[model samples]
Target: MSFQPLIHMFSITVESNTPLTPLDNVNDIAIEFLTHIGYLSKGYTPRSDAEDTSNSIPYVLFMDCFMKHPHKAWTADELAYELKTTKATVYRHINKLKSLDLLEEASAEQSDGKIKKGYKIRFGDLRKAWSFVEANVQMAMQNYRKTVEHFCDLMANDNTD
Candidate 1:
């Protein structure tokens, strides 16, 4: 089953440089922000010709568990058990969050009294974690501006020659 077809737009309108959500609750705010930034979406049902692209579990875990406990380090096994999903599934979502510079790896002692690799929002602060993402985005935009300016200069020189 492919989930590509089932994924649909979930919109949060912007007016005068501010976001406006149709629903004004914390969960909806989380969903709208995540959706706007390409994290969550209105997931699609898989088709016979498509790969099973169901994405709710990880997102739910993030919103309910990780976001709720941003100050705590969560192990993969713990998350998998909590969500009733596999360790692989937990890690897949973890890696995606890590890629966004929102999560950081740390070690934590589990209930079973063993130390395990874990993750928490970077610096135990989502706002701080997002600063890293914003910095990267700003740098990328600056690089693109430089590239465009260089290209224009090259074109001007070419015209002269």
Candidate 2:
């Protein structure tokens, strides 16, 4: 995918003599900050292994929905409909995330005198998760830099001919 620049608005006052130069490297700075804090990373993947034989479509769909609406806890039926999958599939994905400690059962409430389980993302103490992402990203960045250097060396040698 092509890179899309992330921009933020800033307010300035002329009377106060505040510098008003537009941020030229805002995206770079923001990316660095997010990487440092482990918010943006390429480490996220389905919990299931290749040999497990479990389909990953439902897991991917549930992750998409959860990330889009992290604040709201969703029921299995609701998530299944949003993901265009069956309730059984949704439950399987939820179980995977729960195993990873990324999702938590937030509450068990009585609705129409019946107990309903509610699940939410584990946002209360995410330091461990953040650290995991940071370590994975650092490794990925090192590999990416090495590949770029190798490509540049090949191009330079070709140009010398």
Q: What is the lDDT of residue 92 in candidate 1?
A: 74
Error of 1 at 14 (Å): 13
- What is the C-alpha lDDT profile of model 1 across 8-125, one tens digit per residue? 2222222233465566777667755665565554453422232333336755667777888998889998898887778887887787687667888888898879898899889988
Predicted candidate 2 versus true structure: per-residue lDDT over 1-161, tens digit per residue: 99784442211111223232344664444333333333333333434452321224433343455545565567786677775667887786676555445566655344566556666666634455445444555655797699899999999889665
The per-residue C-alpha lDDT of model 2 at residue 65 equals 59
By TM-score, how accurate is candidate 2?
0.38
Best by TM-score: 1
Error of 1 at 100 (Å): 1.5
Clashes of each: 6, 0
TM-scores, all candidates, are 0.72, 0.38
